[model samples]
Target: MRKNSIKNTRINGEVQKELSTIIRNEIKDPRIHPMTSVMAVEVAPDLKTCRAYISVLGEKEAKEATIKGLNSAEGYIRRQLARNLNLRNTPEIRFILDESIEYGVNMSKLIDDVTKKDSNSHRQDEEQDEN
Candidate 1:
């Protein structure tokens, strides 16, 4: 029952930033579209594995291709991390599509539509109340 300290937050943020930059600059895979971005990284408590959530703005085929490309280059990515990060053991990286952003966008659109409908209904009620 302990809170995450500022130092821990900073460390996690640093790791995410490093991973994003490394993937963007170092990993040169044709299958990974330019629209793809590393959104976040969650490292396990023991630091043995890290789940990298990525957001790709493209068709389903493009997303699958990008994920496959990243999975295949996992070994090379781990080696690069070893050279850059001073860790006793580099964690294995797993790529996952971060759908939260997409979900948020969809939710926002739905909310807007609902709001408009409510406003129209309210106006009709007001007109009826006036009559």
Candidate 2:
């Protein structure tokens, strides 16, 4: 299957859904953070390999532990995937830590702070002009 094809997209979505479900409900690993989520999934065109982007809402240690937990359970996760979906080949799963969501949140906060300060400065300038 060609990359970005309809079939590939569908497969990626399916994998992402299943991965989230498995991690959220099935896995009992203590190292896996409860706030962990599957951010995205990219399955190769041949379906031989997959990259799972995972987001954890916590500190650096939590993110690292979550990834470690997921990596340790790769075999079980793959088996679960095969049972849940009828694919020609179950892709080898690789867990990647994704910080985009957290980064975006931080960036938003920074922007808001800047805008607030800018407005406050404008108010001060107006008061000085009036004086």
Best candidate according to lDDT: 2
Measured by TM-score, how close is model 1 to the native structure?
Answer: 0.82
Question: What's the residue-level lDDT of 89 in candidate 2?
Answer: 98
Q: Candidate 2 vs. truth: CA RMSD?
A: 0.4
For model 1, residues 14-95, the per-residue Cα lDDT tens digits are 6777777777888899998788788877776566888889898888899899999889988988888888777766888899
How many Å off is the CA of 43 in candidate 1?
A: 1.7
lDDT of 1 at 54: 88
127, model 2: CA deviation in Å?
0.6
Predictions: Cα RMSD each: 2.7, 0.4
Each model's C-alpha lDDT? Answer: 0.81, 0.98
Measured by TM-score, the strongest candidate is 2
Return the TM-score for each candidate structure: 0.82, 0.99
Error of 1 at 54 (Å): 1.4
